[model samples]
Target: MFDSLNGNQLKKESVMLKKASIALMIVFLMVSVCSARVVDGVDMPETLQVGDAILVLNGVGTRTIAFVIKPYVGGLYLKNAETDAKKIMMADETMAIRLNIISSTGRGTMMNALRKGLRSSLDAMGGDFEMIRTRFDAFQEFFPEDKFEEGNFVDFAYLPGEGLKVYKNDGFVGLIEGIDFKQAFFGIWLNEPSPADSDLKTAMIAGDVSGEARAAQGQWLAKVDLEQEKKAAEAEAAALAKAAAEARAKEEAEQKRLAEEKAKAEAEAKKLAAAKPAPAKPVPAAAPAKAAAPAAATAVATMPAAANNALVAAFLVNAIKTSEQIAVQQGKPFDADAETRRILDMWSKIKAEVAK
Candidate 1:
């Protein structure tokens, strides 16, 4: 079913298809080049004329907030590309920091960010810090009373004698006069060790980012992570120390509790003793006849004066003992062991008084 074309027809068709493909590719490349040069919807001029000198676009980047919202896109222009921030600030050549506002509601936020940036940059230079802060505070008044809306352009340009010229959307906002102030102002977005500024400064310095700048950036990130780990370790140690102290307190409390319990047990034993009734007096033994000479003499000699009233009783106990012995011998009430123990207990009490 092939309506077979000639070899010449097939060759011409293939060539036409290839030409169409090439045309499309060329158009796509052109579009990409055009768009790539534009920054944050604002097209940057290749050269910017400030006063008499022309500054070139050294680098461009977005100022992102919280890694999500972009409040502005910033571009740095310089007479010559310089990666060292101090050199850029002190070059005594014309340079500009251009910002295209992308968020209308972030004027206060932007101001705070600028203040923080200025502080960060000023911290690097160790002289007249209070003067530097005062200068930047005055510089803040140059902004419009109304918060900056989207699409507004703020440009800061520095010339040797003219100082820092401020322009808002191509209109004049006035200038702060001094190279000293210029260095601190530009530092806000050009200094190192900053989360945003370092990257932006590096990109701005070299139109095409170099490996050296990236390396510095890598080291900064590593330092940040290291500091975070150190803080985490300190916090963990604090928690452990607190726990150990709590355990020691609990152990001491338990020991005290056991001591109190032992004291209570001793008090209870004393109370039980105090509650007991006194013993009843023993009954007097039966009366007896006068004994033999040996027994009488021993009783009179060993007896105490305290037992003067009990002599009769002691003699009666001896009589009872004799009766018990007689009863045992006659087998009438034969408990010899009990009878002897009773006689010994009675005699021992009387003897204890005598010894005392």
Candidate 2:
């Protein structure tokens, strides 16, 4: 049939086919743009530009607490759309997870949720916990603020060789390096027995971009209980009060302990003081004695009057005894008067010497 056709017909047919192809492509593009996946009324773009790579939307879901408190719309973007959870999680390719916060989610809550989920995911995957935890802690540091407000888009974009880059809206937060970390982080959403909601995990992997799914998600997300919000606020306030009171009590207890320790130390010091011995009083030195005299007369002169008298008496007694012994040997009765006279003379001489 082609051999029978003329050149013009061939050219015309070629032009028509090209036009049809272009029209089909245009329609397809329009449908793609118009059928943007909506999660909780937020239109999630089909493609995301991360670094130098353009990523297609793999799945979309909402993070909720008890299926009522819708906090954020989570969308996974990859270089290729994949439904296989493990494959996507383990792949070291350019991918991203966009979290469009639709409610007032506290930073602490999100951080805790992420840490718990990522750790559980890594645990199930079975790998080095220290490495996982180190990276996980680093990832948590990206969010330093208190709360992710409504309309905040927090993105975790994984660059092939550059690790995971985090962004808040238009601002670049920080990066966590390593493929091991990236795998565990992605596993939080894709791992089996994941910490995320079952339905949410399914939606993220399967990516059901249907009107029904969107409508239901939006309606469910829109259901906000004012009483619940108020109660949560009151509860938060109460917790803050309790923490403050506990801190005060702890400080007071510490102060009391210090005071008691000081008092005990002082008491110990006083007891030690009382048990100590007193110092002895100083003694006065004695006066040195005078040098003795050389001669007997000089000695008698220096002596006290009573001492001199006693010495003279002792000499006189000795002389008298000697005289009596001499007389007994040679008729002492005949020499009594003579002896008395001699003794008298000697006494007089001794008295004179003592006076001198």
Indicate which candidate wins on lDDT.
2
RMSD of 2: 28.4
The C-alpha lDDT values of all candidates are 0.66, 0.70
Candidate 1 residue-wise lDDT, 1-356, digit = tens: 11123234444545554554555454444322112247768776555658755456678887777777887788887765566766786666788988888877555777788777767767766535577676666777887465878888889999887889999988888888878788877777766555355556666766553233333334434444544554554555455555556667887899999999999999999999999988889989988955433333344444344546477567646655665655665567545466545544656776787689
Top candidate on TM-score is 2
Give candidate 2's error at residue 21 in angstroms.
24
Worst window of 10 by summed lDDT in candidate 1? 28-37
What is candidate 2's local distance difference test score?
A: 0.70
Model 2: what TM-score? 0.48
* Per-prediction backbone clash count: 1, 0
Candidate 1 residue pairs in clash (backbone atoms < 3 Å): 59-204
On residues 16-41, what C-alpha lDDT tens digit does candidate 2 reach at each position?
A: 54554555454444333324677798
